[model samples]
Target chain A: MNIGIVGLGLIGGSLGLELYTHRQQTQAQISNNPSASPSPSYRILGISLEQKICDIAVKRGVVDEASVDLSLMSQADIIFICTPIAAIAPTVAKLIPYLQPHTILTDVGSVKKPIVENCSALWPNFVGGHPMAGNTQTGINAAQHHLFVNKPYVITPTANTPLESIKIVESIVDLLQAKIYHCQPEEHDRAVAWISHLPVIVSGSLIASLRQEDNPDVALLAHYFASSGFRDTSRVGGGNPELGLMMAKYNRDALLRSLQSYRQTLDKITTYIEQEDWQTLEKQLHQNHSDRLKFNL
Target chain B: MNIGIVGLGLIGGSLGLELYTHRQQTQAQISNNPSASPSPSYRILGISLEQKICDIAVKRGVVDEASVDLSLMSQADIIFICTPIAAIAPTVAKLIPYLQPHTILTDVGSVKKPIVENCSALWPNFVGGHPMAGNTQTGINAAQHHLFVNKPYVITPTANTPLESIKIVESIVDLLQAKIYHCQPEEHDRAVAWISHLPVIVSGSLIASLRQEDNPDVALLAHYFASSGFRDTSRVGGGNPELGLMMAKYNRDALLRSLQSYRQTLDKITTYIEQEDWQTLEKQLHQNHSDRLKFNL
Candidate 1:
């Protein structure tokens, strides 16, 4: 099946590579203009949306092909909307006129509810998806052919989302050799908020806390001493700040709720420390130890 | 030079195995008696400390005959006080009479200030040392000869600390094939508070937050969805909680100060989110991105 990928950045470019590796040719549409460089803004485009360069690369056999028109997506059997959260709505709105009734639509967004809510009605064929795989690198240059190998590809389907379309999307994800899991749109947001969104804030807070120290030596030393544990925790936080802020904005209620729950947990543990209740603290540690054993990772 | 290890738990036992592999013998004292377990209600007899274990083991041909010791660590060229943070102070107090002036004393506690402060005045032969190497496994059974290989062995020496004693401890750490660095008590505490202690709390907070969810399905799904990043970040939190709590409690002032600093940083970023100040958020992310780049990890 022919796949149409929008944006051609990390998510987009990676998806293109994965699709091609699966022996499916992809028709990619990069929306930015190459000759007219935009301001170095917070948009994902600054990192990935290279239309002209991508077009040249595609012409030179870097990719199968590239286009600037949304109509090109009309002929695609499956279309993956791999754009930023803000751009997803507009892109979906524009593509609605040309999106085939039977075409399977999916996205690689971290937050699923907003996009799914906004586009599910616009395109009855849409199935909200998030490939739970990413690296620190950005842009098409950072895209790897096997980046999605063995990663979880979450497919969030609403009551209105056609089962056949969900299956088609799953098949595409399977073709990339990614495992697929099913969840509701709201569930997807809450899950990502707990694991992905909260970590960013926590890690960012860690970095910011060190920055408050007046002594540059201490600040520098703290940074130097940060090990793999600190890096992993802070990985998502050191990502695009604008993207982080946007994620918090888009999933504000869920993120806030998660943060509130998290604050209570922190307070409880802190109180235990204050009271010198080592027994209760040990129980809490046991709970985490038992809980963490379930995941293969 | 023969070494005496007081406790045969994770740190102590690991040290024993490592010492044995290097063909250097160490006398170990472990409490084999069930009574001397962590709980006060448990029995307290014959809890073979590393010193005792190594003594018997060496005599029984479990190790070289050259390694043999009991109460008097006077024969020990150096004594490694490898025990829990809570046990470090009192144990050292009890063992001080046995420590000769030339016997270099060191430990592997996560917190160093209290340890250094407690022993510096009490034991003239003491030198505060923390081998920042560890694994999830504990006890003598988990001991490996190479546990300390390539890891940082932080040695905190006071202003009044003798230079010869410091060199002796450094040479011992070098024999273990670990990197050695020297810092003041406060500096060591603050550095560990940022890298080791702080990550534990943040990770525990994350685990506790996820556990608070009343929805069983979401909790189960979260367990399934937990990734390598979560595992790495939460490793310290899921560790021995009593030990974690003690580290936080012993280093309470530094940890509390760091936590307050962390919360304030989080508040600033949360405010940015509440107000949708994406520009300021972006700048902070860039700053963090740059700051993170400075770290070796």
Candidate 2:
């Protein structure tokens, strides 16, 4: 089955490489622009996603051919949108005319609800996709053929979404060898707000707060003392502020709601601290610790 | 040099193993609790620290001898107080009478001001030491011979402190193969307030807010999608609430100052987000990104 990937950034570029690689071992005809060929009309990323992607593809040997046109979408059985959240809608709107009638469409957006709404509004055939994979590093240059190894890829389909389309999207995710999970669009948004978005704001606030201190020496020590644990907690919080702010804004209500709920949890601990209730505090941490261990991540 | 370690918890137990391993290599005449047998200590940690420490020391051959008695202070050239914050002062008070005339004393408490204060008030021959090594995984069971490897060990000495005592503590840390950092007591607290304590409160607040959400499904999803970054940011925040509270209380004035400063920074970001100042927000985040990279963390 032909799969057309647009954007060719981190997510899109990696997907293209993976699908191209999969075709090598299987009985599939993968069409991608050649690595070295400078397409006269195609817009490659940065210098040339057209050239670099094909070179990587050839080096990794993923696709027989790669290109930069919606004509690629015309031959594809499915199309995956791996662009940024803002670009997803416009890109889909632009490609709808050329998209095959029954082709399944998906995305790798961190936020899902808005993307689903915009895609469904723009195109008759669209299935909401949210792949939960990231590194602090970004861009097509940082893309690895195995970037999504063993990561969760969520597909959120509504009542209007056809079951066949859902399966086709799932099949593509399967080809990428990622763990597939299904959830509602709103559920996806709410989940990300808690795990992904909220952490960024919290961490940014924490680190940003440090910048206010007058003691540069202690600041240096604090940074030195800041180890793996500090890095972990501040990881999401210290992310791209625009992306962080956008997540909070797009999922504002949900995030604010989550924040409210989180405050209550924190307040309980806060009260326990004020009252000096060490016993309960330990119990609460134990619960959080236990809950944390339940997830594979 | 004989090093007497009081309170065989995470820091003490780990130090025991480290000292033992280092002494063996350096062929130093280390005076410790000879009765303190060495073992894997993991099993001991699961039971009780007192027993776990004893067992681990004996099984691992960490000490020539071990004792629970305060007199252990009299024999040692240096004493390292590796206990919780609450115990540091009282332990120092008790050990002062028994310590040798020139004994070098230090601690492994998270906070330094109180320890330094207590040392000054209760004893003259003491220096404040904070080995900046820890893991979320606590207990004697988690003790390792090399837990302090490549970690910072901060030495906070007051105006009254003896430089020789500082040198002794630094030597111990160096022997443990840890990096050394020196800062004043207040400076250390402020630094921790920003990077360490701030993250804890911020992360706890974030996690606590999410727990309050009405939709448990969303909460569960958020928990699932949370990766190493989220966990790191929230690490200190999710720690023992009593410890967190005590930290705030002991360093309340400094912490409050840090918190207020942090609030201001966060307020700036919030205002930008609320104003829909995308360009400003991007620039702010870019600055934050650059500022964060300047630290060694």
Candidate 3:
């Protein structure tokens, strides 16, 4: 089997590393069973727009082969599109000419519906995936084989999606020891809007609102007092700007719904404060505290 | 010199531990210089309404002595009102009968203005102190001596406040190895509205909005999908409910202003997304990314 990875950024690079690691383990098993289902036959080929990134990826053992050309993916049984959301569809479109008859294309997009719609429209075997992992860090340099371990990896499958394609994604996630989840493309988009996409917008608004104060003294002192709470709340807002923008761009409607829900909650709290309704406000805040405890985050 | 710590919770208990450690260091210094400022002379007296908490604090050596009676604080030269914000003024009023002529009163309230107003009206030597440390964990069991080390410790002094009273609080902050910052009570309130108080409301709203979805399946799955981003963004929202409420109650006006500013930013981002203005939205997101980087948070 041959696996092709497009865009050697964090997801692609990490996937390459995990796949390579899995390949070695499978190779050890091949000594016992030459043609077992876990046969060590898969080759990881990475694709990138930057020749430099490709060379570095190969040196880092993220891939057996890498190229700037989409044609490099033609020999693979499966191809994972790990590009940014804005580039996923276009990258998939460029690879359409090279897609083999049995090629199964998938993606590690945070948003699902639009990417699924675009890619599945172009190719029938596309499965939309989202590995609910990663820190604010990005790029090839930050990638590691351990990223997906024990993390939830959701695969959004349209009715037109083949079972075999979904299982292929499951197999990779299984190799990385990630939890598997299956949901409809639209459902995945809506759910992540509240949890993932919505957080980006909410957190971004916080940073955008915090300006260097009119008084320089106050501004300097504000940073001194920002503390751990501010650091955690503002983390996602400081994530890859392009990636955050793309999530908002692709998952606009659901994210808008999430914003509305968030606004409604904020309005209620704000009105309680504005009215000096401390009892009700305290009650609401208590609910929030308990609500968060339920998640144990 | 003797120190009184009121309301033996996180701040009070931690201060007790720290003061005890400082007392030991001063004891060591006593051997070197019998008449120096570090004369090993200070004793820590802790006051709490709960007998169990008081008993446990003494047993844990958080204080040299602990008592439920307000009279226990009468012997101390300085008193730190470490009670919840909602209780600070009332606690101060109750402590007034016990305050000595030279007693210097300070507080570890997150919102300084209201507490300062009430306390200063009751006591002449009151200095508003806010040690910007502590996790969500509460009670004496969670307290440690090192909680305030190298952290920001703000002292908000009113025009009516005596320089001697401010220095007394500064000395304790210095003993804890914390960096001391002085500001007007109002300025401290406003600055923290952006960095501290506002984040509680922002984070709380995130959790309050994330409910058991209308669809139970969606609700359960949403938890599975709520990743590190959700955890970080919702952290402060899950903070001590009573503490967060008091911040909102005491610093209501400044926090309201922060909410308005945050809403305006959110409105702008929402408009861009609603209007499908990708270029503007992307630009705004880029600014957010850079804005947060400036804080290094």
TM-scores for all candidates: the values are 0.81, 0.81, 0.92
Please compute DockQ, using alpha carbons, for every candidate against the native two-chain complex.
Answer: 0.36, 0.40, 0.71
lDDT of 2 at A253: 59
Give candidate 2's root-mean-square deviation (CA, Å).
7.3
Candidate 2 residue lDDT tens string, A127-243: 898777767677666677777778888889988998888887887688677878788999988887777766666667666767766666666667777765566665665567667
Tell me the interface RMSD of model 3, in angstroms: 1.4
- Give me the candidate number with maximum lDDT: 3
In the range B1-297, model 1's lDDT, one tens digit per residue, is 666666666676666555554442221121444443242111111124545665554443223432233454655667777778888888778876766666667788878888998887777667888887777787655666677777778888888888998887786577679877777778778877787777778788888788888877666656657776566666666767666767777888777777777777877887777677778877888888777666777
Docking outcome class, model 1: acceptable
Off by over 4 Å in 3: A32-38, A136-141, A212-216, B32-40, B50-55, B212-215
Q: Give the range of the ten consecutive residues with the poorest summed lDDT in model 3 chain A.
A: A211-220
Pairs with backbone N, CA or C atoms under 3 Å apart (clashes), candidate 3: none
Q: Which segments of candidate 2 are over 4 A away from where they belong?
A: A28-64, A100-103, A136-149, A240-242, A245-250, A260-284, B1-3, B13-59, B100-104, B136-150, B171-174, B238-253
Q: Give the Å error, residue B267, model 2.
A: 4.0
Cα lDDT tens digits for candidate 2, B226-253? 7766666666656665666667667665
Error of 3 at A192 (Å): 1.2
Best-first order by lDDT = 3, 1, 2
Comparison by DockQ, 1 against 3, better one: 3
Lowest summed lDDT window (length 10), candidate 1 chain B? B39-48
> How many angstroms is residue B229 displaced in model 2 relative to the true structure, after the best TM-score fit?
3.6
Task: Report the number of the highest-TM-score candidate.
Answer: 3
Whole-model Cα lDDT per candidate? 0.71, 0.69, 0.86
